[model samples]
Target: MSIVIGDIAKECITVDPSTKCQNVYSMFEEKTALEGIVVVSEEKPIGLVMKTHFFQKLSTKYGFDLFMNRHIDLVMGDELLIVDYSIPITEVSSLAMNRKQENLYDLVIVTKQNHMYGAVSIRELIMKLSELQIRIARYSNPLSGLPGNNVIAETLQEVITYKRFSVFYIDIDSFKFFNDTFGFREGDEIIKETAVIISDTIQTTDNEPSFIGHIGGDDFIAVIPHYHYEELCKEIIFRFDRYIMRFYTEEEIERGYVQGINRQGILDNVPLVSISIAVVHNKQYPITSIEQLSREAAKIKKRCKNITKSTFLALTE
Candidate 1:
């Protein structure tokens, strides 16, 4: 589940609307770090009063003499933000950042089902947002700018929850040979270009909400609708095969292979890279968990790779 405001909201002090300014000031003096207090009526937050604003009013020339005895409602800030406790922290951060400049430091009141829940500080909200962004970045493949292995597992879990979707585990064949001969820079470019090809092909198709994740290097995973899974796979392989040669030399392109040192230290010719897609759809197989889906896809991927061509193999029955 997504992180919500209630996860970080702090318990706040509340006072009645009829509470005098002098009484509110006393509360502030007791809690030196308290920035604001919620003004509630019948256990529902109605307004907010920032300690600085209240003290400023009291410190004015002859101001204390006039409003010290007056009710806090006389100087309380009415323009306040009240958010549902279940709202996403990221969303709340956006709302807080967009507040009026002068009132930006004000506390945000949180409510649950129309009842006062608590309050959130803008500073805490920002910190949570920053942490979320860092986590996303950490799980993203730097080369392809696509979500990496960690996100792939999470996405698979979510797709499995729906109990109706196809997972395509994609891999590039003979990729290591190309990387060995072409060098790391060229290898990185191929990975980046492959990501673009997959993303672009998916966009051209009318499959909405398609998920494409890179599992680092030359491997990727995609969550697509079951209806058009085969057609989409064909498109990806065709586009990749057509465009992959652009990164190859004229001789390698004409000869259809590149020469590289094999793992056994023997110099030999290696075929150009090809894509292998292993498709597993819950419609045909009952996927109870991400582990089952991954294990099945890996099994199918090995079979697809042995075919010596860019192709996709799907689970049948």
Candidate 2:
């Protein structure tokens, strides 16, 4: 899923600094399609000479006579954009665009361990960047594959403005426990699994008007019917308990916890990961603002975490 500049660089004709400008001109004349020449010294790129810019300078008054016999270094454009072969193309694209306008179309020199590798044309860079983005969107999610916090806020507003909707705030209980004990990669899988359960459960809740979003890592929000929330919450908890257990081992489950360091840097037995859902609505209490809904959900979420298993608590009062 990772693509670097080297992956897209094409072979570029190279010259040494001491090479004559006349020699460079002949090379360009001989190769009609040659776009640029890289100047190298001690196996490292030091400058670049673009065909368009080179001819532009040569076409100036007395330009050819004043420079043709001189060393190519004297006439070659030193304003350069050089990037490491290992740098991601996404980052390199920004560097390429930010260069001085005169150097905008210059071939970007690619180096490996600081030695010359090849050159990437602006055309190749743009085409590869677009293609990589398409692949990433289709496969990588950019990796989370969920609508983000801004969408979550809009969902909240819609709930308050238009209709009576139950808010479900799903938090992974002691997610840090698994994240610390197992590492982020393993923890990420847990988050993805939890997302699936929430999405599937909400979608099946009598096909009521609903929306779900990831409020970033390990926290999710859903809006569903006020009437159907009880069934949906129980189903989410049931499915979570059944499916999430696969991420743990028999020994850890038997022991009922994993060892992890807490925020105070104290080592302790952190309980197994569980789901906590705080269900809130305007039915029992006046939902005046987003902040109030959050305040109520936070209180219910705290109480839900106190229980020993996957559980849900509704806002009361």
Cα-based RMSD of candidate 1: 6.9
Runs of candidate 1 exceeding 4 Å displacement: 144-147, 151-214, 217-288, 292-317
Number of residue pairs clashing in candidate 2, backbone atoms closer than 3 angstroms, sequence gap of 3 or more or interchain = 0
**What C-alpha lDDT values do all the predictions have?**
0.83, 0.81
Q: List runs of model 2 lying over 4 Å from the truth.
A: 1-141
What is the C-alpha local distance difference test score of candidate 2?
0.81
The per-residue C-alpha lDDT of model 1 at residue 215 equals 88
Best-fitting candidate, measured by lDDT? 1
lDDT per residue (tens digit) for residues 1-317 in model 2: 13678989877899999999999999999999899999999998888899998898889999999889899888778878888876768778989999989899999999889889999999999999998667544433233666676556665766786356788999988887678777899888888888888888886426445666787778888887565688888989898888878877899898878777877899887788888899898786578788988999989988997886788888862
Where is model 2 poorest over a 10-residue stretch in terms of lDDT? Answer: 135-144
lDDT (Cα, tens digit) per residue for candidate 1, span 1-317: 23678888888999998999889989999999999999999989888999889888889999999998989888899988898886767667778889999889899889999999999888878888889778878888988988888878787877787646788888889888878777889888878988998888764435544678898779988876555688888989999898787877899778877777877889887778889989898886578898898889888987987776689998872
Candidate 2, 115: how far from true, in Å?
A: 74
TM-score of 2: 0.53
